[model samples]
Target: MDHGSSHDDEVLGKAFDLRLMRRLVRFLVPYRGLFSVCVLLILVLTGIQSGLPYISKIAIDRFLTLPWAIVTVESAPGSGAPIPLGDDRYLVEISSLSPELRKEWEISGVLSPTRYLFVEEDSDKEGIALEHPDLFAPIAGGYIASESALRSLSPSETLSLRSGAIAGLIRLSILFAIALIVRFVFGVSQVYLLQLTGQKVMYDMRREIFGHVLRLPLSYFDRAPVGRLVTRVTNDVAAINEMFTSMLVNLFRDAFLIFAVMGIMFHLEWRVALVILALFPLIVIAAFEFRRRARAAYREVRRQIARLNAYLQESISGMRIVQLFVQEVKANERFAKINIDKYKASMRQLLTFAVFRPLMSFLSSFAVAIVIWYGGLNVLRGSLSLGALTAFIQYVRMLFEPILELSQGYNILQGAMAAAERIFILLDEPEEDRGGGEAIEEVEGRIEFRNVWFAYNDEEWILKDVSFTVEPGERVAIVGPTGSGKTTIIRLLLRMYPLQKGEILLDGVPIERLDLGFLRSRMAVVLQDVFLFSGDIMDNIRLRAEIPEEEAIEAARFANADFVEDLPDGYRTEVKERGVTLSVGERQLLSFARAVAFKPEILVLDEATASIDSQTESLIQRSLTKIMEDRTSIVIAHRLSTIREADKIIVLHKGKVVEEGTHTELLARGGLYAALHRLQFAELGGGTDPAPPSPSFSEG
Candidate 1:
């Protein structure tokens, strides 16, 4: 097949990548012993595969046909020493003659193509030969006849006369059967061992990649698509496994088989072997071209598969959003487009195979034809045995069979190389800096953010030179407008992102100096939108921590989450994905329960009660009063009424703290806090304002 049809067919160099392969070989280190066994099995299997044809050759030359040839050495001189027969004839053992000398004699008209079987005197078969005396001719110490003459005998007599040959054929059949059984046993063992090695390698790679991903900074995941990362863990790794199991194994087996076939062919008949090898250059060229095309096709196929998987993952995950917005049709169209792209890529790959398969078959047939045309004549002239010629045909087919498989190997190698490149790229990313600092067992809950400035993008500050302090056992409520960097402050306090300007300290020590795990373990945050894994309610509350079951129930009770006891399964009820079966208020209760179960020294609530109903909010408010009695609590809420009784209320407008006092004091001051309070007071139909009215946001 001509592989230049594809526009993306770049270069033959891409067909094999050495650098990538060298890196991939590191995974094979632990399994090198098993891999060596696979290679050794390849040699054994190839030898057995090459021997089957020769077995048929032996049956044909030694058992089915006559062994003696008539030589007319009286007139033309022949090379081999021949026994002189009466009447200017010579009895020649054709099997004993060298190929060249036998052909020379036959060409010189000394050797006759007519073969004869000689029956020894005093043997059991001699009785049958004597009865058919007309067909048998007298020889020195034996009786001889052409196979044509023996055919004139009766069936029972023929069977008796050829009983020795029948027994030999039976022995050869047993030998063939034994070879097949051994091949089957070893073949199964080889496949099992090879696949085992491949699976182990895959397991190691997946584990390493997953562990690495977990250690990477959250910023990397912020921009990276979840679906694409999933592909790295799954599809990409499987592609590399294909390389190991199918391509690598087949490469070793095919090379051994090709060389084995070649060596045996030359041994059987060198001249015919040369004729078959004359077409070797053509096979090489075709393979090289096919490799280039196959690499391009495989790359395209993998790319399309990644796109398809990514789109499907995203669409399924956002099916709720798609349906809510009535975008299901658009989603389906997009999915169909990606699906069609994968289909086209797969069709292109199939087309490459379809063309190459038949081309290899043609070359195989061409090779066979040359062998038959050349070897047939040599057989007739007594130079090549008919057995050897038949074996040559089988060997030619065996030689080209691997070429067909080699095409598939090319695709496997290309796909795996691409997957390896992606996987290595991900592995090369630096892990999150794990705060190479002190591991503190405990700390007083005193949080301070000093002159902090930050932004997700370059210098577009989300927080600008902000400073705040929360003393030990203090409840602080931060009230702000929607885009007032309230959530950004929480993220900075937790060290989810680095500070651009100033520093954050926890209990007088820089937050970055504290071990990351220890820092996070000491504090717990409950946000408005709660997240839950697929598990029972109790498991969700306790998570991976060694919290006692009774402690979890107590935490749930403290969060006013006793509603679970009213249900059929109670705390053991199965939580579907993200706790979808539970109501929003119930999920919030679970979140609060989880935070309380941790018994963190510091607690953060980011608009925790904003999304709940009034009844649930009242329950949460009562629970909050008890939970924050002695804990350091930071609350960011939009509902101004919720913070009226706080120990301190900080009013923030556009990343700056404009007012700092208790809620009553801020309302008395009549600043941004009083204006925001009045705006909410008018909207909620409250009776009157506590202080003199401040201008609303638009009026101010």
Candidate 2:
């Protein structure tokens, strides 16, 4: 009931429709191994990425936090000896010393000899002496001090401490480097594997959709515009490809990343992780809204693009008519209107993305601010280490990246869903019925239309009670004015459309009961308008059939297509789109050659030579007679002169058979056929006679 372009009316569907997703997943079934590899790589990559921040935390807490100072130690009297504490430091036991001696040691900046600590002092007084200066002396260069004492290290001790600190820093740096390299490797591998899997899946989907389009009923195409179908097969399929190659795998990757970051944050500090989690609902809301608007916008974009394409295809195809009628300005105006519609749709999609991306970024930044504020307080309160707080900040930032990416991926998913809906709709269309009847390897060319009535649309009959029969090997010419159901009869015989009220028999077997391919293979029909694909002449003749090159050439010769040999490439001569480089007569000859190559048992010509000039018509007529010989031929012609040699003639007018007989007998009857003949002859500047001799008349 809608009357809008079918492409425009295509439903957008839900972004995550389960039924549609299930259908999409079926495409990945054959590539499960690749998909498995990509999943494994994503998991590994996420793990490595999550661990890097923890490694930084370790460097901050362990090695970097160690104190930087030098200590002085004294051997306890004679019984006390210095004990090694490893790494160029020593300890002494002073518990055995007398209290007076301990007091003396304490006054001299020394603890019990066993546990001496470093103390800081003025560099200018490095050599200054005191009453107990001899008692407290730095071990490496000057005096000994207590464990609790603060002393500046002598030059030698300073060098040793600096060297140790540098070594620890180097070790941490090496660990960081290792983590960085490992993460890089896994990241690259993950991306490559995921993209490869997506590409392969896309390839499979495109192939399957194209194959399905080829098998749809011809009647479906009769109503569907070429441009809309092209969009379905090409542009719509590409949108789905973008989803596969970018969105689908990235969806999993981003989810893994977000969860991994959350887990790490919680492990470091649950309270800080909760701060980030509190923002998740907001992000989810934004994502949902983005998906909704984006899906609608993208659907509009697709619809507009379909409209633009259809207009362009129509305009370019009918350019000659437009120019001849001086409608160039009007045509341009129409094109500009369609083009602007598409442009507006595209900009809407752009604006949606532009707004959503930054909005996501803003949410992510707000979450990060929350983490920094809360986590910073915990670090300052001494409840959380500075390193842990820093890691939390990093994790929070990483968390939002995936959220933002998830939002963008959702955008891709929405577009892909719209595309998938259209594609699946096409795939769901019923294929042409191949029929369950017995197959026929061969058939006598006998055709009969028994009281057949048909309409392309609801009771608006194109043919009413049309009945006729042609025996085996009989040449029957159907003469009619335009729209008299002559061509419709030919279409019905070829089973291009279903019969509504009658049966068509081929060789005494109803065509509805014949194998579609076998039935079609037995007959060849050439239309008044010739269509040629962009290929060499030989390919056009052979089509999908495996006719040998020599045999194709022989068929061409039989059809009097000798002009092909005169072309630069001979049989290999390139035919541009629609065979534009060839003359009208040449295209007709090629069609004849195609029919001849197929070697059909029945031939149907629907005014095949109606458009050619007088000279070209003569050439085609000679080849037509050759191809029709010994073959049961049914010719629909406006030019009565062309059908004069037929064994029988059936005259049609207003969807009914007005008369039937051979040419002379039909002329003698002075019915529709005679009137048409007289009109055609008079147009050629000849006078009509009641009884004329058998003269060679040129066809219009």
Local distance difference test, each candidate: 0.81, 0.75
What's the CA error at residue 671 for candidate 2, in Å? 3.2
lDDT tens per residue, model 2, 356-382: 888987887787788788988765543
* Best model per lDDT: 1
For candidate 1, write residues 18-101 as lDDT tens digits: 888898999999999999998888788878998999999989987888878887755533545455677788877777877776
Could you tell me every candidate's TM-score relative to the true structure? Answer: 0.89, 0.82
TM-score of 1: 0.89
Query: Which window of 10 residues has the lowest lDDT sum in candidate 2?
Result: 689-698
Clashes found in each candidate (C-alpha, N, C closer than 3 A): 0, 18
| Deviation in Å, model 2, residue 139 alpha carbon | 16
